[model samples]
Target: MIHAALAASALSLSFAAAAHADPIKIGFIGELSGPAAAVGQDMLDGFNLLLEEQGGKLGGHAIELIREDSQLKPDVARQAARSLVEKEKVPIITGVSFSNVMMAIHKYVTDHEVFLVGSNAGPSQIAGKQCSPYQFITSWQGDQAAEAVGKYAQEKGYKKVVVLAPNYQAGKDIVNGFKRYYKEPLADELYTSLKQMDFSSELSKVTAVEPDAVFAFFPGGMGIAFAKQYAQAGLSGKQPLLTTFVVDALSLPAIGDSAMGIISGGFWAPDFDNPQSRKFVKDFEAKYKRVPSNYAAQSYDAALLLDSAIAKVDGKVGDKPAFMAALKAADFKSVRGDFKFGNNHFPIQGMHIMEVVKDGQGRLNLKTIATPFKSYQDAYHGQCPLP
Candidate 1:
């Protein structure tokens, strides 16, 4: 029995050594199944595109992508993160879908001393007191988009607005963000289940309140589901719906005609009218045969961020401090036009309030309405420890 145990331990050690000897592993953990799978798939596609462009390499090491399907569950995300950091020993982890799942996996990454590159899922805690030097967000925080929406709504003289969200940390952040800028009276504040797809009851509640506009922050599949239900319940035409991160490409196509005339706040869109953005839009459309969502753009930016870090470190990924410094410097061509890192390692980039407009051919496109804010910073940045 002692000999058998010795043999097993030896095999395990050998496997570990072989893994280390192999290519550099980067983890992509998100919802690869369920209704939100398209978002994860787009993120993976964009990340893979970067890898392919770089010939599947970074820092003189062959790139090996480790994908984990969180199924959009926090516990599942935590398990995947543990496997990546503890078992696989990946240097960097990226592409978490839900905010709760990101929160769940954050402790593990910080504790294990692994760098986390966030593609989506930007929780306020990561930007605030719980912020870590090891964590860098490739996208804006949860409230930035909603803040833009709020600013736009205020400018448009929207009063007595109704807010709908999925009763979570992200939801609260978005609502608070809107309220921070929107001094108007709130007609209703409705919270539904995190997993709730049916918003009929909530819509009914909104109808009763009769707000001038409705703002929401439903991400991923929930966004698609909620938008569809919102349209079916005739709220789309009845009331002016303003949203952020909810009516993105992932749900826009699903919402079809219902998505048309919908106004939302965004940091990046396919028709952003920048050279880098044009290239990304064309290439992603050719490769994926569909419009790339904001998640995809953020994922592509994450890859570029890693590439920049690797270049700055001169093929020495072993130096975590140097890599982190490069990331903090924000020395990459962001597909989102302009890019800079905030004090909290979150994006300090331009935010636009966009409306979904259909072209002559009836193809859905985002049209910029107003540049309510530019190069915005998250409210929690002052509270972060990082420079």
Candidate 2:
């Protein structure tokens, strides 16, 4: 009788251990140790914060988030994806800080049937005809922000606007998208190397042209450098500098007062007056001791998206069809209120024109000025075959 009781107790303990089981693993790959580190770190923080709020579980299943640093290199990103998929065997992988890196690892993730949810850097190819059914973007296409500022420039009657960006995929996309909407004679279009720190040459051209306005799409450290140099060159006072992804919460703190009065465009900002937005901003500030950028907000939304989909399928991430269907439904509450995925797996959302303003705390922050595209969808959606 005593032996039987001991056996029964051991069986009960073993059953309880099985019931708890191991966590559902999710992989995050991004540029966590380079010029783009801030953007990647902020996104990771946002994703972790969402999981933290849910008690480290999504869909009632414990989660194990495996993170890898791509260092903003394509080869590194590919290797990271391989390790995550093969070794960690994560069902979902998200977070790509740069379009270049995203492009590098896109095929591997999608081909493996691992759901790839982009927190940032939605390159044009992934949003168009080449879009994979397994991939979804919670962020704007690389051009949407530029398009917003471009339309604003047109409406404001900026006749000759000079455009500048890094000579890369995202840079080209920004210039193209702006031209598509601005429809203005270009004063000059400048493309610099991704690592170019000295913008004196470009600024000199802008000064010579004396365009009605100047627009740029510099991200990460490039933005900080450009904004500071623009001010030092005495151009910010004379010509309005309109930008995208260059003067947000992440860059503004680094750019300081130089970012003030700079008009920028984005889909989300710290001051967006929604309950979800407010809560996210407040919680992020309290935890991170800094204001969250749109990148962070989008990453948070991505986690929530996964949570919603996982719950819908009863945490069965293995149920690919059911999980994908749940993701398409987009049942999560986004901080950027109007969030919905277009057929192309990119967001069909509004874009806001924002101006950098000094908050009461003497910090630069984005304040919404206008909603240029109240209901905007990316132009390439028609080419996407995914429904």
Q: Could you say which candidate leads in lDDT?
A: 2
User: Compared with the true structure, what per-residue lDDT tens digits does model 2 show for residues 111-228?
Assistant: 9999999999988888898899999899999889889989999999999889999999999988888998898788899999987889999999999999899999898999999999
Estimate every model's Cα lDDT from 0 to 1: 0.85, 0.91
Candidate 2 residue-pair clash tally: 0
lDDT of 1 by residue, 193-290 (tens): 88788888888888888778899878777888888888887788778889887777667777788888888987887778878788888888888788
Q: Which stretches of candidate 2 lie over 4 Å from their true place?
A: 1-18
Off by over 4 Å in 1: 1-21
* C-alpha RMSD by candidate, in order: 7.0, 2.3
Q: For model 2, what is the alpha-carbon lDDT of residue 315?
A: 82
- List the pairs of residues colliding in candidate 1: none
